[model samples]
Target chain A: MSQTDIASRLGWVAVDWGTSNLRLWAMDADDGILARAESDLGLNKINDGGFETVLRDLVAGWLPDTLSDDNSISVIVCGMAGAKQGWCEAPYATVPARPETLAAGAVKPVLKQAGLDVHILPGLCQVDDPDVMRGEETQLVGFMADHPDFAGWVCLPGTHSKWARIANGTISGFRTYMSGEVFALLSQQSILRHSMQGADDAAAFENAIRHISVKPKELLHCLFGIRAGGLVSPDGQQAGAGAAILSGYVIGSEIADIMARLGRDESIALIGAGKLASLYRQALHVHDFDAEIIDAESATLGGLRRAHAALTKS
Target chain B: MSQTDIASRLGWVAVDWGTSNLRLWAMDADDGILARAESDLGLNKINDGGFETVLRDLVAGWLPDTLSDDNSISVIVCGMAGAKQGWCEAPYATVPARPETLAAGAVKPVLKQAGLDVHILPGLCQVDDPDVMRGEETQLVGFMADHPDFAGWVCLPGTHSKWARIANGTISGFRTYMSGEVFALLSQQSILRHSMQGADDAAAFENAIRHISVKPKELLHCLFGIRAGGLVSPDGQQAGAGAAILSGYVIGSEIADIMARLGRDESIALIGAGKLASLYRQALHVHDFDAEIIDAESATLGGLRRAHAALTKS
Candidate 1:
């Protein structure tokens, strides 16, 4: 849609602002996306007073000229922008939190910019349980919207991976794993970087997953083995195998931990996309667990749209 | 001792050239230290052809003035400087390798310098096993020399921590854990750094060790708990506790792996010193394992001295 058409049709805006990036979608009354926009100004990049400016700059072209002076466009946001150190603190809604009712716990920060009614959605936290997640709650909520009666484990794999227990339409509990962070630190920053510099090797990855699943205690030993493997592994095969093995060890450990916590009987709903998703799927197959892959982008959009619709209806 | 006295008494030189630093000791026939020297120029710091130059620069003052022209001082070297990428490749002496007999595997490289006969000692490697150690082999040799009848698990803790199975006076097989590297990367490079900055907390460290022992599979989950724990832990306590917990998790996992490989019944000889050694001892106590602490510096010195004596005798 053209900017002019979006300007006229834009009744509300939906956003998913995270640590490193901000994504926005302008929507009409019928839930159609009139226009879409994004900014690299994630919470980490924007100062306390700079959120309003960044948001306005991104959506300024979507405002209709005929709108009255006092009229405001509703904007719904999720993710890190709601954290304590973010634009405005949106205190976490403790679990078991109904995904649909997240809007009730939302906070509306006072904005200097006119013609904008913004509601920042709250993240989820388990008080006594040792887990916390910001933007992932929105994705979980969106996943629930797509499958209302879904009740099982939902795995959101990323920088700090999350595994949530969804019962009915509410999130009962969740756990976070440092798998992605571990993988990144070890592969790129640790001594393993020299050996782990290459494309993925599926067979090596699967072999690692299988090895870790059977002997989880050897995880640390297996990590050092990468360096030794690099030293001994003949020329061309070393780099790719090293990287793939590292990935498998990290991801496999996470899977092993989750299985230990919540048994391996149930199938997991993997809320991820691209290479990471494929890797997780392959890992799950190696561990003998069935997984249904769900695109994270759509889940984020779906959650934001669902939240926006709910807020507008009220 | 004065340079002249050291020069007159020096019969041979002993050096431990590792990845980050080079340590040398001027020794007499009776193993009395004549002089000591060190350099920051480790194998990683120097180029292929630069090893001899750096060694000569460090020990040039120790050469005797009365020595005839073309007479060379025998310098016995150990550690990473003898690796494939170091001064010259010192082929690994595969296990079961007798620590006292490491001199048999020594590789001599012709030096450009006139007054130096440098012999690089080979490190120990378990060819079919997934482990290798360079400098630690010398320490193990010294430890074995000090305890001839000792036959058990010997741990040399550092960046790449090694656990060797010593039988009689020979290293049977061994394994390496990236415990120190994991702790360094997580506490310094990963996001956990912020929470893991302060003086050591003994209580937190022991608590993490005990927790991981019972639930070894929850290792990754406990790692994430550190981040969440940081968020909730009261101010002032977070940093130390986070550091301690990270230390516990990394060290705990290593201990857990080693215990899993070798039963928990056998005692472990911890070849380490300083704060890291103390922490490992505490971790061992928490895990119900008896650890006999040995001074690392003394062990390295002893190993180098023993190797030098053996070479001179041969």
Candidate 2:
């Protein structure tokens, strides 16, 4: 749709702002995307109290020139934009919280922009267990909306990977792993960087998966082995192959931990996209666990749409 | 000892050249230390073909101004200086190798200095398993000399912690864990740095050790918990406490791996000094394994002494 058409038809805005980037979508009343925009100015990059300006700049083309008083467009945001360190603090809805409860937890940030109803949905927090997740709760709500009876585990793989338990349409508990960050540190910043060149070897990955799964205690030893392996290998073990093995060791450790917690046979709802999702999926398969893949972007939009509908109805 | 006094009495030299620093000891014939010198010029800092000059500069004060043609001082070096990438390549002494045979594996590089006999001792390498250790082999030889009948595990904790199997007065097998490096990276470079301020919390360290030792597979999960814990804790947790916990998890994992390999009952000859050694000793105690503490410095000197004797006699 053209910019004019998008502005005229826009019912609400959906945002998934995170640590590294901001993604915004303009949606019509029918839950169809009228326009889309994004920026690399994630929470970490923006100055203090710059969220409103950043948001306005990115979505300026999608906004109508003027609106009748009280005829404001609803703007719903999920993720770090609602975090304590983001635009404004949106207190977390502690689990066990239902998908329907996310809208109630949403806080409307008072913005300088007139004729714009902005709501930032709160993330989920578990006090006694000491775990907090932002942005992911929206995805969970959307996942539950689709599979209302998914009384099992949901895995969202990312920089700080989260694994949440859904029981009777409510989140009971969850855990996070620093697998992605650890992988980056080892491959790009640590001494292991010398031995790896981002090569992807399927065989090396599979072997590491099998080995680490059986002996997770040997993780650090196995990590050093990668350097030793590369140093000793006649051809230096193709960098891609070395990287694949490193990823396997990292992602494999995460899989092993989750399986140890939630058991091996239970199927998981894998919510991720691109290379990360594929890796998680492969890791799940290696452990003989069935995984139902869900595109993270779609889940985010569906989640925001669900929240938006609930707010309008209320 | 005064410099002049040490130079007059100096019989030979012992040098431990590693990745981060260089330590040279002027020793009398009986292995009595006459004087010592050190430089930050480790393998990683010196330019290509600069090891000879760097060495000579550090120990120049001890070298006699006018020596007879055959009155050169014997300078024995160990550690990364012998690695493939270090000063001069000293091929590994593949196991099962005896302590008395290290001198045979030592390589002499012709240097510009006239009155310096330099012998670089080779590290140990396991071809089939792809493991390598440079300087620690010297420490191992020294450790064996102090306790010739000791046959069990010897752990040298540092950047790349090592666990070797000692039997029949020789190194049968060994393994290295990147625990120290991982700890440094996570506590200083990774996101966990925010939560860990390099604090030394005894309680936190002990608690994490006990917990991780029982369920080592929970390491990644526990690591994420550190971040979550800091985020949720009203005080953000004492940086020291967080760092101590991080250290515990890393070292505890290493202990768990070594215990798994060697069986929990066998005692370990812990060859380390100061903070790292104490940490490992504490971890070993927590795991209910007896650890006989050995001074790392003495072990290095002893190993070099043993090698020098073997070379001169042969």
Worst 10 residues of 1 chain A by lDDT: A231-240
Q: Write the per-residue lDDT of candidate 2 for residues B1-314, one digit (tens) a residue.
A: 77788778888999999998989999997889988888889999988889999998888888777665488889999999998888889988887889866779999987875888889999998766678899999999999988888878999988889999997798988999999889988988888888876547887888889888888878888897887787776575433488889888999988887777785345588997888888888888886777888998999999999999998888
lDDT of 2 at B150: 80
**Per-model TM-score versus the true fold:** 0.96, 0.95
Reference-based lDDT, residue A180, model 2: 89
In model 2, the Cα lDDT at residue A86 comes to 86
Each prediction's number of clashing residue pairs = 0, 5
Residue range A109-211, candidate 1, lDDT tens digits? 8988568989999998775645688889999988988888776789999988899988768888898888999999988888888887677789889988888
Compared with the true structure, what per-residue lDDT tens digits does model 2 show for residues A1-314?
88899888888899999999989999988999887888899999989879888988888888888864478888899989888888988888888888778899888887776878888999988877678999999998888889887767899998889999887888888988889889999988878888786657787888888889899888998998888876666465533577888889888988887787774444589998888898888888897777889988888998999999999899
lDDT of 1: 0.83
Best by lDDT: 2
If candidate 1 were superposed on the true structure by all CA atoms, what would the RMSD be?
2.0
The superposed Cα distance between candidate 1 and the true structure at residue A206, in angstroms, equals: 0.8
How does residue A302 of candidate 2 score in lDDT?
A: 84
